[model samples]
Target: MLIGVPKEIKTHEYRVGMTPASVREAVHHGHEVLVETGAGAGIGAHDDAYRAAGARIARDAAEVFANAEMIVKVKEPQANERAMLREGQILFTYLHLAPDPDQTRDLLKAGVVAIAYETVTAPDGSLPLLAPMSQVAGRMSVQAAAHCLEKEQGGMGILPGGVPGVKPARFCIIGGGVVGENAAAMAIGLGADVVIIEKSVPRMQQLHRIFGHAVNTVYSTRLTIEEEVLAADVVICGVLIPGAAAPKLISRDMVRRMKPGSVIVDVAIDQGGCAETSMPTTHAEPTYVVDDVVHYCVANMPGAVARTSTYALNNATLPHILAIADKGWRQALAEDEHLLHGLNVAYGHITHEAVARSLNMPWTDPHTFVRD
Candidate 1:
């Protein structure tokens, strides 16, 4: 098997699919690795490093895409990259397809076997592949919000942790999952008053035990979200629905009611966001003002810290990559139920139920084609 790594071409997406260490492991497993020239530049690994790791560097993405049996990428294929996909070729990457109809259509047209990292699940129902970036983005959300809260950035000039005699800023996190938990830790560590609104009683109780008197855990509801969001200085929306689009818990009216110059960082923007006003933004211009409230909705917040994100992601994805390379995708999926959940589209058909339902497309069970 030949695994190809192409440089990410998304707006300000600087992470690469495979690190030299990942390539070396694949090489050790007797798989050939092809990396497009400068693919690892974002993470500061040059061609020489990949070459030293037994990877051949292609002159361009076209050559790599044309030759490799499996394309390993950090982000989903862009329009041009999607056009180059061949039938039966494997695309193992983060395909946030529930919100992106065009990408789903393109994958179907290309007849490629698309395996999304974000959709893979662990035995305990945790998202193992998506956890590293969730941690990265969750930590970054507060940093972004703190910057957005500066007066020059259209915020209320409120510091996240106030000085002596001044009250600290209030932060409302809309989920208690990995993203919300990491955000709460960061916010609380910075001396900000934090409240986490979650629906799960067990999870909320765990959060209560984790934070004790430091953080407030409230049962999530329409009234609670509205009240908490309106009163908060910064609201971090970290809600997720696996491979489906994120539920819009914060309405436009709720945004309108928030205090003037407050910040809302929709960390769920990758899954189409949890706010009605949330639109994908880039690190170049990461914020927009609506109803006089600051909204930071960068779709790839982890991408801004490419080196850290790339290493963390490769750590989680390498074993799966090795599995696909050594056993082939069919055998790999057949052997690992968790990996089979990653299959979204294969041979012009949608294979993931959540993605199919979200896009209003028919889905064939992945197991049916695993033996085909």
Candidate 2:
């Protein structure tokens, strides 16, 4: 099997699909690795490093896409990259197809076998591939909010951890999953008053046991969401519905009533956002003022720390990538039901039910493609 690693081309996305270490592993597995020239520049890895790792460096994406059986990428294929895709080529990446109709259309037209990292599941029903970046994004959300809290950034000019005479800023985190838990950890570390709104009773109890008096846990309700978001200085929206679009828990009217210059970091922006007013922003211009509320909705927050994100993401994705390379996608996916869940589109058909439903497209069962 020949695998291609392309440099990510999304707006402000600096993470590459495979590191030199990953290439070395693939080579050791009897798979040929082709990396685009300067593919690892974002993570400070040079083409020579890939060469040293037994990877052949290609001059451009066209060569990589044309020759490799599987294309490994950090982000979804851009328009140019999508145009380069060929029939039956495997695209293993984070394709958030729910909110992007253009991308969904292009992948279907290309007849590519697309596997979405976020849709892959573990034995425990956790999203293993998505967890690394979620952990990064969840922790980064607090850092972004902290910066947004300053007056110059359109925030309330309050400090997250206030001085001796002033009170610390308050934080309201929606959802108590991976993102919300990490956000609470960061906010609490800074001595900020933190409240996590969760719907799961067992998870809420777990959080209470973990943080005790350091953080407040609340049951999620329309009334609690309204009251808590309106009162908090920083509101982090981290709710997610997996391969489906994120639910809009915070309405535009709700945002309009937030304190003047308050901040919102919508960590769920990748799956669309939990706020009605939430729109994707970029790292170049990460924030915008909305009804006197500051919104930080960068779709790829982990890209801001490319090195850490790349390594962490590679750790989670490498095993799955190797499986596809060693045994072919069909055999590997047929063997592992969890991996089958990652197959969103194949042979000009939508394989993932959630993604097809989200896009209002005809659904094709994934098993049809997995011939044992």
Candidate 3:
């Protein structure tokens, strides 16, 4: 198998699909890797490093896309990259197709076998591939909110961890999953008053056990969300519905009623945000005022810490990449039911049910394409 690693093209996105170490492993497995020149620059791994790892460096993305059987990327293909995709070519990356009709349409039109890292599952029903980045994003959300709280950044000028006599900022996290948990950890570490709103009884109990008196766990309800939003100095929207678009738990009216100078870090922005006013922002301009509240909705928060993000993501994704490379995607997916869940589109059909339903497209079971 010949695999291609292309430099991520998304604005402010710096992570690469494969690291030098990943290329070495693939090469050891008798797979040839073609990496775009400077693809690993963000992670401090240069062309020489890839060459030393047995990967041939391509002069441009066009050459990598044209020659490799499988294209490994950190982010979804941009318009030009999508145009270069050929039928039957495998695209393994984060394709937030549920909210992006243009991307879904392009993938279908290209007829490529699209495997989304975010939708890939583990044996325990956890999103293994998505976890690392979620962890990074969750931690970063607090950091971003703290910065956004500065008066110059349109915030309330309150400190996350207040001075001797002042009260610390209040943080409301909308989900108790990996993102929410990590955010809570960071916020609690900063001595901020934290509240996590969760729907799952078991998960809420687990959060209580983990945080104890450090944080509050509330049962998720419309009234609760509204109340929390109004009182919070910073609201971190970490809600997720797997491959589907994130539910809008915070409405525009809710945003308007929130205290002035409050900040919202919508960590779920990648799956579409949990807030009605949330729109994708870039690190270049990561925030905007919405009814006197600030929103930090960068779609690729992990990209800001490219080196750590790349290594963490590669750790989770390398085994799956090797599996598909060694066995072929069809055979590998057929053998591993969890891997099959990662299939979003193949042969012009939507293979993931949640993504299909979100896009109002017909869903085809992934099994239909993995059969021997």
Query: What tens-digit string does per-residue lDDT give for candidate 2 at 207-233?
Result: 999899998999999999999999999
TM-score for every candidate vs. truth? 0.99, 0.99, 0.99
Q: lDDT for every model?
A: 0.95, 0.94, 0.96
How much RMSD separates candidate 3 from the native structure? 0.6
Candidate 1 lDDT, tens digit per residue, 89-162?
99999999999999999999999999999999999999999999999999999999999999999999999999
Q: Candidate 3, after superposition: displacement of residue 165 in Å?
A: 1.2
The lowest-lDDT stretch of 10 consecutive residues in candidate 2 is 5-14
Candidate 3 colliding pairs: none
Cα lDDT of model 3 by residue, 151-170, tens digit: 99999999998989999999
Provide the clash count, candidate 3: 0
Best by lDDT: 3
Clashing pairs in 1: none
Candidate 3 segments whose C-alpha is farther than 4 A from its true place: none
lDDT order, best first, reads: 3, 1, 2
